[model samples]
Target: MSRQVTPRAAPFRQFIVKVHGRCNLACRYCYLYEGPDHTWRTRPAAAGPKVLDQTATRIAEHAARHTLTDLSLVLHGGEPLLAGAARLAAFAERVRERVPRGCVVHTTVQTNATLLDDRRLAMLARHGVTVGVSLDGGRAAHNTLRVDHAGRPSWPAAVRGARLLAERYPDAYAGILTVVDPASDPVETYESLLTLRPPALDLLLPHGNWTAPPPGLPGRGTSYGDWLCTVFDRWWSAGRRETRIRLFEECLALLLGLPAATESLGTEPFTAVVVETDGSIEQVDSLKSAYEGAARTGLDIFRHSFDQALNHPGVAARQTGIAALSAQCQACPLVAVCGGGHYAHRYRAGHGFTNPSVYCTDLQRFIRHVASRLRESAALTSGGATR
Candidate 1:
């Protein structure tokens, strides 16, 4: 058994509320719906007013106790907009009204961009909610796997929604999120997304672990790392003024010995928590891709406080920093930078999460690549030349 590390007392600052439990589109690679966990099916399809009210109260209590100045409320779901714009807006307002004075809530809704129309965007904006859209890539061909339940392509509607946000509601446009597809041309993929004029980009790795490997991952291959490096070079070479890529930027920050935290990098405490539509409090949703019940905390807003959820073994494990890593991981030079490569990606069958990430080699390769670029840039600067 892995050693138990003392949990951090860090308060949760990011709350992902599952407003609706169902999605209109059935993307081929959706881990939450198709993964081992079936908890969503048992929960309410949408959060009833009662659940929302109690959840908001609980959130406020936690924030007040911790004296948090700023928090993030991400209205998430299989697709959050399915809960209706007015309902979502009202819920955001309620939460804002409930939070303690001076506690600023940064509200955002992560959607597939298929349901974002003029009316919906207007309502969300009025409620002070920003929009984050998920896309495989900007090109239609890049989004071939993102289809609706009827097996019809979602790119057309999705593109329209994205364009609408950029054109009419730029203030509400948070960014575009893309899951890296190693098969696609990395530079081309990055450039295509730039056409959407997103203020930022969130490039993510597909969720996977040793038990069930991610798509396109071979026995010993760094295809994913190679893909990331290709994009990193393009972004870095361009002076990185195109837009922010969260993953790459976080990597750079960690390498520079600065304080940074992301699911994919850094030793910062994981301060994000989730609230199911049925009022259950759980760990981050990414654990669903690891195994069944991987994210369950056996706690709910009705009977438990967010502080109690913080002590759950799963939640604590993530916040323990380098102590939660495996023997091999702890001995590694890149341990601090990678932070064991996301808590979920470290799971192995019988050993639980006490293992190095399945993406260990890939992380090493990518981290070194970024470090080398940083060194090159420093050298150029010292030599009185622009990189």
Candidate 2:
């Protein structure tokens, strides 16, 4: 038997605040709207003042209890921009005010980018809220999947908004988040995003599970791995870190035996929590991709502390490291670097989250490729040093 791993009592360092429950655009792949979860149908269109106040209070109390010095608050959504600029500014300021002395709060908003205007940008900047936009890739073809409710393309508006942010509020422009579509040419995709000139970019795997599974994935092939490796080669050979690709950088760091910075591929305890629009405290919202209520804790910011939500079984399991993984995963050599993939990707109805990620083979292939490149680089460095 693998040695048991204990859950670390870490305080929440990131809080994802769902300021709006409905989105203007209806992206077909949205887990919240298109997935099995229907809970959003019952939630209010936007978070009210009461919910924001209680959420701020709960976060402050949690920080004090844990003695946390730094925390990040992400204004998230159906589309956080739907909450309007004034409300978002007020919410961010309220949270900042409630934080205890010496505790720093970094606020950011992740938006679909269609609603971003100069006025909204000014408001967000005034409140010190960094803006992150989601763009699938550089070209309109690359963003065909990200469309509107009327089946119209949203790329033009999104691109326009992204450009405005990059040009007007460069410092406050956090970065871009793109979901990898294996069908898109990796180099083209990378270059397309370069047009926006984001300070950083996150290449996210489409959230899927064993039961539901992500689109375009074959029954037994590493299409995603191959695609990412192509991008990796291009980025690696560039001879300079032009743009920060979160997943690639994190993988390289982990391969070099350094700490990974992201939750997607690390043994670091999961310290992020989500507050839904209705004041419900939940685990990371990604769990909604697993099934209905997969992310729920039955705790609300109004009545419960973040500490109480931390003790929920689902939340605790994610922090337990290898003990929470299946036997197959614990024995794998790449377990440490892959961290058995994201917790939500490991779900199956009968086996639960104990299984290895649905993308196990792809993860193995990608990690090995990165490790091999690192080893080759190390060998050349050592040889040059000796000579």
Candidate 3:
């Protein structure tokens, strides 16, 4: 599926590709594994040979033609680490070689640390795959729900794996994606993570919608907002000089009257696409909130090609016209900044992605909290430098 073949109206900034559906660790909070979309059972756990080949060709063709500025190819999955080092290495090489001249392929991976090790890090470093590990927080915070299929705690193994990966290839060790568990002590969690000094940290909102609600997070009040605000208060102060916290950055951007850069946090209808293990391309997996089959485009990447699907009416329809999705969202004061949150969270059985974010109120509250802090940060600054 190709988009009109014309120079993209805008360059493709990021593309989240599922390298494999098989994961070494089965974290309970994962959207791909735990919540919804059990389609992985029938599909190839790891990316197939033909699928990777076709993908390399298609991605290269697009990069060659389009004037892309930042074509970020994120290797995701049940856990990309499950793909193994050799195959993953070969896959990266193919992508690097095929990318059109001058168009750098920024390869990245979002993985659970259970499979990360010295060897894996070495291979990842060789392929230039910036690796980001998913860990909730310290031992207690992490073990809360990041358990295995057998209900065993994965924290110890995950910590060992992360330590090995980071220690071996510090440069390639990218960042961290931590899901905020509302029940945990935000101050402790933030401080613990700060000790790692990751290049960046992405604080994830729990995955659930108005229908079922995120675990430990209620559908009402400012529960998540409060939790995030607490973490933000600490991280903003302790985020290691230049360390980046994506969620808080977006919040400050909005507060400082700058356009929001992160689509997940704000109302920006980001250009994100996902190809399932079976090669079914669809909107981000989070849209699993919509229905059992909300995401599938009913097409395989190997057979149909990304170029073909990129132009499919179904795919194109949702990509644009996002601002018009919900009446409540449109009228909300934070509409411009939050962009009604992720497109998938816009569902409720009969209701669709048109309703406010399950955390809409929470987001607004968090935004306000950050906005207040930013004001104080600015007010305290003497000549734009915090005291």
RMSD of each: 3.0, 3.4, 2.9
- The estimated TM-scores of all candidates read 0.97, 0.96, 0.90
Q: Per-residue lDDT tens digits of candidate 3, residues 7-80?
A: 33333456677888877666655676666677778878777887777777767766766655457788888778
Look at candidate 2 and tell me the lDDT of residue 211: 89
Q: Which stretches of candidate 2 lie over 4 Å from their true place?
A: 1-7
C-alpha local distance difference test of each model: 0.91, 0.87, 0.72
Query: Candidates sorted by TM-score, descending order?
Result: 1, 2, 3
lDDT of 2 at 207: 94
Candidate 3 versus truth, CA RMSD in Å, comes to: 2.9
Error of 3 at 75 (Å): 1.5
Instruction: Extract clashing residue pairs from model 2.
Output: none
Candidate 3 deviant stretches above 4 angstroms: 1-11, 216-220, 239-242, 312-318, 382-387
lDDT of 3 at 40: 70
> What shift in Å separates residue 66 of candidate 1 from its native position after superposition?
0.3
Tens digit of lDDT per residue, candidate 2, span 1-387?
A: 112323466678999999998888988778889889899998888898899999999999888877789899999988888889889999888888888898999999999899988999999999999999888897898888788899999999998899999999998999999988888889999988989989889888889988888975536899888888888888889863778888999999888889775777978778899999899999987899999999989988877888888788888887787788899999998888999998888889988989988888888888899898889999999999999
lDDT of 3 at 307: 55
Candidate 1 per-residue lDDT, tens place, 1-387, comes to: 112323446889999999999999999889999899998988999999999999999989888878889899999999999999998889888888989999999999999999999999999998899999999998999999899999999999999999999999999999999998888999999999999999999988889998988876535889999999999999999999999999999999999999997998988989999999999999989999988888999999998889888878788877888988899999999988998997888888998989988888889999999999999989988888643
